[model samples]
Target: MGYQFETEKVVDFILKNSVKKVLIQLPEGLKPYGVGLAKEIEEKAGVTAYVSADPCYGACDLPIQEAEILNVDLIIHYGHSEILKEAQKRIKILYVEAKSNLDIGKVVEKSLPFLKEYRNIGLVATVQHVHKLEEAKKILEKNGKKVFIGSASGLVKYDGQVLGCDCSTAEKIKDKVEVFLYIGGGIFHPLGVFYTTKKPVITVDPYTKKILNIKEIGEKFLKRRNTIIAKFSQAKNVGVLVGLKFGQSNPQLAEKICMKYLKMIRKKELEIILTKLQPNPNPKILLEQYSTPPEIAANLLYMATYSFNDIVGKTVCDLGCGSGRLAIGAAYLGAKEVVGIDLDLAAIQTAKTNSRMVGVKVEWVVGDIEVLTGKFDTVIQNPPFGVKKHGADLKFLRKALSLANTVYSIHKSGEKNRRFIEKTVTKNLCGRITTMVETNLVIPYLFNFHKKPKYRVKVDIYRIVKK
Candidate 1:
């Protein structure tokens, strides 16, 4: 009677009915994961089984044709609460709720108070949890609440069909409701709640039978979710830091370089001082604010080579100078004063802490370089390589021209047109300049399922003094 299938009752019906063959109806959209469940049922029940090819409502509906084709006496359905009228009499439908990681009963109970507060609410969940969605919605309705179930078209059949999140369905109904109640096994089931509407979102975990903290789940969810705006922001002049040795992502390394550049910009804005932490095998590693990977000593050296610092003692500017590696290198080479800038407050703070290690006074600030103004005798920096996140190499060059007497910057060498960059800088810069091209030293590393070469670098040191 209820949405949940009682195992004993289903088994009793199957045994008593002299079921010679069994048919399993899985939602067309949920078939990929349902195939495994069907195999288990056949092995456990010792019965011949058939799976319906017919499209279904969350795997709840099956064609009467399947019963005739398989000649099965019983059919077990996965992930749907309703059966089509056509299949009702021909097939003995045993609707078993797909197991969820959350406790459904407790989730419903905990959400009663919230549901009662809103007269009308929108309900949504992922395909895996759709079986319990109707029942959950009904419970809210029974408590004097109105529920509108989102209409989600079944998954597409094409190979290229990108399975979009169910949130789009929720978005359609957002304006019609005062609040949204997401009933599913886990917070993942109701991600649509975050984007669909500004209405307060309540997530019920059917497996835990509890109402969870939506804010906590949302925060973690957003951290992993990639956005187009963020991508563009990172694409400006980002650098990704990958390890030269082993077990690292090449693309990730490129991103790290970008983060370092941004951190340098932030440091300038906040006027935070920077210090270099000890450079051991593992430098105090953390992803920059823009999601660049850890900056290793090898990366620092690569940046140094790319930075093209001329004879030391020239006042140098290190834009987005994370940990002051390039700045310190310039200082060590005899640059008079080294200035490092970054956008990350933490990196600037740590840079100040590590400045002692460099044994040099490097001025690090937390700010964006687009707004900073100053003059330096030379500018040495490793601008981000803008593969994953945007980089600010252009901004660095522009800033260098505006604030310094000469500029030396490192960037990805393999980008589409290396010559165009030289032209851009030459065109925008105030005076005569020289460019030196060099390939980024290739580093090999393992990450996830892929291994790749990391090298996209061209270092340019330009001299521009007021004519």
Candidate 2:
């Protein structure tokens, strides 16, 4: 069955606004349908429609600039909410949520046994299935169970709908419900509920016809995190990595965690906020990278390089060197040979300029880290968390471990990650974590989809040493 694209509403909105030229933007998954969507809009509304080809990350990444560049009178955005209020005033937007058509009745039917235990259940779904949640709600209500779908509040405008960053809908009704019923697909959204509320979750995946009880998953997560916490009890000379990616950097929270750890752990006299751009804890210079914060980066660096032959005269490599922050920092710290690698040409160019501005000498290369091969005394990197590309971080870990005896890297903090990171590092790289630190990363709102000034991300910095 085809997904529901309410394009007629798009025409109504365009005609109502009396717009002529329209700019249409779609997310990566919905881009395949953009051409057809644009053609239909133009034919019905009699407006000139141009589809934005540039990648769209979320609703936050609206094509307002593109609309202005094309001089379009209106924009038809698909697959996300209106993230920026001010931008909507300047550029007229018609948001077309391409909701899915998968029937939740069958899945709800299959979930009867698991859900029978709960008297009341709080229901939530991602934007894709928000429209169809009513069907599932009806089935649940008709049975003995009482259903509670949270009303629209805060950043999210839809009742019971959740964005990746905003899950208030579920959080709001968590106490009222006996169990959480995620009326959508996948473990991701449901896991968020389990993490937030520590409640048993019945994940009704219509596509897979699998009703998953996420209690075991939550227990596994808790067990792993408990272990990591125990290890952190011993960390002395800690580095808190500070990243600058608009969604990943957080200095204020990093400081709090660092201070908290200092109070809890036995002190070794060295605590630094290691950043790729700035080593200091100055939040003003928190240029965005996707890895750990500066202090955490330094912690990882210190952990990886402390026992090393030399840091001032050592070789260091930073994979996925966004804007050359890590590479420049390594050079400034007196590393004799420092190399930074990234696939993004623009980021590499920016890194070069940053290096020049800082008066630092570092070799910058534009290519996949996998293509290059060389030995370094230490390797430090903030690779992608693999949220989009599964095991993307593992690729960097394997490469970094191959090139150096010691590696310092950052990853999203979670119980599932503990076992995975330990198992993967030991099996693939023949390495184990000699040191680790957990801290909150502040992710500022860069795109329209982000309503708050920033979001908090829990991340872990690890120093892996060869066995």
Candidate 3:
């Protein structure tokens, strides 16, 4: 009741976009207002609105597949700010943060009695009440207490805001503050703050006018976790459960857990692991988003890992890393750090999901090769063949050479093209082509112009070393 749903903005968006059918998704706390909002949309915008009964944890838990199944043109998701910017391209989602307008002076006054022992207090709140943190800070400072609010980073949108998973704001100011004052309703955020900072946390629920200390809850959670760990340590066999949800899926962590028990993994096994990775859902023609085949990726990584000894325990970068096959393969092959850079956000998102599915860690960036900077031990890339866009391969080669001493790049195979590439790398790029391996690149039907189910094009993989 204290939250603003922004009903007028939702109606205006629907009318402007000509969204005939829309789905309304709300958190459990905000579900009570769903029917009224839907009614308003139907009356004002003249659009059919259906309220989803499914529980939403955060902005990451988007019911995009459900919306797609219902064939809705747009989804109005309430109670959270937008976290998954990539998902918007798949389904049009409008996020209403549902900012609360409740006065917190009474709650802050109530919390002062419990805060008498502490001088320096760190202030934080959920996005709903993040705006009220200054008011709470003023209240605390007036009572002869120092208040500090951490600046925003990553998932934290506001200066004093904290997400259920991200309590960085509290952690950032934990050293300066003796205790944390969380101005939100639930123990979920406060618990995160307590665990992350290991500082005493006091929660002031503005709605209920209740005060709570979360140190005891955090202690109990730790005890439970340690007990589970103790039991798990005794077990000989353990099964990994992968979360299939967009927000819940964490295959990268699961992979790490599994790898802890494994001995030296072979190239064949790495290839098999990579084969299970999900391909880019949306590939652009201009970018030539042809994902490297599993066998080719494995072969390239094997050459770097086994033959050249460049990948293992070394930093690697994948230039124009489409769906992150090459970069992920390098990480799988024991690269200390792997970075995958791409211009397409959609491709980067798919690459992230694929890395999670394979249980490997890779720094995925949504940007062009020109944006990439830093030195790496090795660089691997499958750049455009200069077909749709002329001289695309030269751009990738030049960028790769600048980033790493050793570069493995793929280009269209031909006597004329190979000679041109060799001269370009040697003369202009200040690099020498050490080895050139001719391989067949299998291109599956992606664009509308493709005539066959699949076709093979001869391509040359050049291993260039900086002179």
Candidate 4:
């Protein structure tokens, strides 16, 4: 089936708005292509164009605050529809539809050589390309290979619609098959499949109609992380930092923190209130159902085990509290008062319920630790990590000394900036810092959703007191 887009209509819309600065949201699969199109449009239309490297999976999963900051007149968001209707007025969003035009038979034909003598093979692709799945399966099966079609749904926008960029279908049944074949246009389609499972991945590019062999497992891991980081850098104001959390779900703690601030203080508010929530306490039920992200356990344990004295009856803070675990632990240990802050409403909501359950009188404030203010006697928090959350450690450490006379921060151990932090603190705050503790947390079977084995995250605990 051949389809055509109204390019003139898009051009007319831009012309009507007198738009010069345009932001283009590329699809993950089509980012490299979209970048080219964006550059072409800029040259032809004589407009300033920005192509976001971070192609949204579906709708507006990525935050639009960065676009708003750019003062962009129009957003050329490709692959998905406009998920956020509110940003429509300030940001004119035009979603470009991206559908597969590859020859499935040719893709199947090209993949035969890599099959070797394997009898069982699995076929998968992103939701937009899933229509070719059965055809791919039939072709593989016809060649005397047992074929399995992965039944996992990618990120869904509304109902029954796949998120514009997800390979859940490939990831779900990757383990069952001996070889995985990715029949898509770009490396993005196969990269997800390769990461989630170790099955040898082969990608067939639709644009060129050729199959390319992928890298080995180790290289693929590093590639996936770099690809994700490249996408994340396009945003202006907002940043995501992930680390070891104490819970099962690998939720973006930094994102949850920013969302919390969005709720508490409207965007119109001038002075931003910066706060942190580190939820402590874990329900065995969640762990029983799913393994916790390795980083979570690593971070919380670092905060709990670090020894600091003379902090009793002093106001204390816990940033990115997952389930109020650290806050409750602080209160129990005799802090004058303790405030637990987190962006995850579920975590904060759970913390409140758990606080009552455990009979702890802890103040649970929901906000971003990065924007938190007001001085305190002591500030301690196991901020979200870099593995899952990216900006928390830097943000938390940067703001810690400003928040209290005595600052304690827990972050990934072995980071190169430990000495730099010591230097900055001594210079800025006129204080000397001391390393209090170092902890290592290794959790196996925690990342059921991850492609890698058990993760071991190192935690560094620093205790900073005034000179």
TM-score of each: 0.33, 0.49, 0.56, 0.39
Candidate order by TM-score, decreasing, is 3, 2, 4, 1
lDDT of 1 by residue, 114-164 (tens): 666678887766544555666776677778888786665444221111123
The lDDT of model 2 is: 0.75
Order the numbered candidates by lDDT, best leading.
Answer: 3, 2, 4, 1
TM-score leader: 3
Query: Can you give the lDDT of residue 237 in candidate 1?
Result: 49
Alpha-carbon RMSD, each predicted model? 19.6, 20.0, 22.4, 19.3
Question: After best superposition, candidate 3 residue 378: deviation in angstroms?
Answer: 40
Candidate 3 local Cα displacement, residue 227, angstroms: 0.6
lDDT of 2 by residue, 341-385 (tens): 887777787778778877889898989899879799888888888
- After TM-score superposition, the amount by which residue 311's alpha carbon in candidate 3 deviates from its true location, in angstroms, is 29
Q: Which is better, 1 or 4, measured by lDDT?
A: 4
lDDT of model number 4: 0.59
Q: Write the per-residue lDDT of candidate 3 for residues 1-467, one digit (tens) a residue.
A: 67888888988898889899999999888899999999988999998899999888888888888888899999999988877888888988999999998999998999998999999999999889999988988899999999999999998789989887788888888999999999988898899898899899999998899999988788778655544443343234568999677767889999997886455455567778878878889888888889898877876776666556789999999988988889988988789999999999988998999898878999999887899888999999999988889989889989998999999888889999988998899799999776666678899999899999999998876678897
